[model samples]
Target: MPTIYLSPSLQPFNKYLTTGDEQYWMNLIADDMVPLLEQNGITVKRNTPGTTLGQAIRESNAGNYDLHLALHSNAGPVNLAGKLRGPDVYYYPYSSAGKRAAEIIADNLRKIYPDPDLVSTVATTKLAEITKTSAPAVLVEIAYHDNPQDEAWIRNNIPLIAQNLAMSVCEYLGQNCAL
Candidate 1:
């Protein structure tokens, strides 16, 4: 079975404009994703809620995982806070596998997000989770937590978001995702 290391955001202080913190909602989505992945014959290992980002990367590196998927809601730069919207799926610029995974994730997210055009795949080397992991990695910024509309959308569609993400992972792994 293809294995994944699931790292939900640990940023409890990054509060959503409408309801909960980034950590709370990201964990809820990750919680929903686990069973769907398992049902599709994928092995899922997850970071603990309180695990620091460094610790999560270390744990994922120690495992023989096919992918490392980090779930998070975004926050724009201070000047653009609460104004920016949409999902940004990120990957290490040098990893083609990471780019493929990120693109697949962004495409899948476009199906559910309000504006399909706003969902994009970004290539970067600054993120620790993507840069330090042994497995091919994609870090999905599901939506802007600082934007009210985006926050509400995520809060209302946790299960749908999780399902879409799980399906995307299955696609990347070449597994059948019936749901």
Candidate 2:
């Protein structure tokens, strides 16, 4: 079975515009992803809510996982707060596997997001989750938490988001995913 290290945001400070914090919503999505992945014969190792971001990275690196998927919500820059919208799936610029996974995730997200063009894949070296892990990694910023419309979309479609993400993982792993 392909194994994945699922790291939801550990940052409790990133609050959604109307509802829960980033950690809360991401964990709920992870909750939904677990069973979907397991049913498809994938092994998932998740980070604990109490763990720090550094610890999450350390633990994920210690495991022999095929992929490291980090779930998070975007927050715009101070000047652009509440103005930005969309999902940005990020991968380490140097990793081909990471880029492939990010692309697959971005493509799948386009199907559910309001504007298909808004969903994109980004290459970055700044995020620890993507840079420090041994396995191929992709960090998905589901949507802009500061934007009410985006926030509401995420809140209303948690299960759909989870399903889409799980399917993306299956695609990357070359596993057949139903639903």
Scored by Cα lDDT, where does model 2 land? Answer: 0.94
RMSD of candidate 2 to the truth, in angstroms, is 0.7
The Cα local distance difference test for each model comes to 0.94, 0.94
Model 2: per-residue Cα lDDT over 52-140, one tens digit each: 98899999999999999999999999999999999999999999999999999999999999999999899999988999899999999
Q: Candidate 1's residue-wise lDDT over 20-137, tens digit each?
A: 7999999999999999999989999999788999899999999999999999999999999899999999999999999999999998999999999999999989999989999999
- True-vs-predicted CA distance for residue 34, candidate 2, Å: 0.3
Q: Which residue pairs does candidate 1 place in steric collision?
A: none
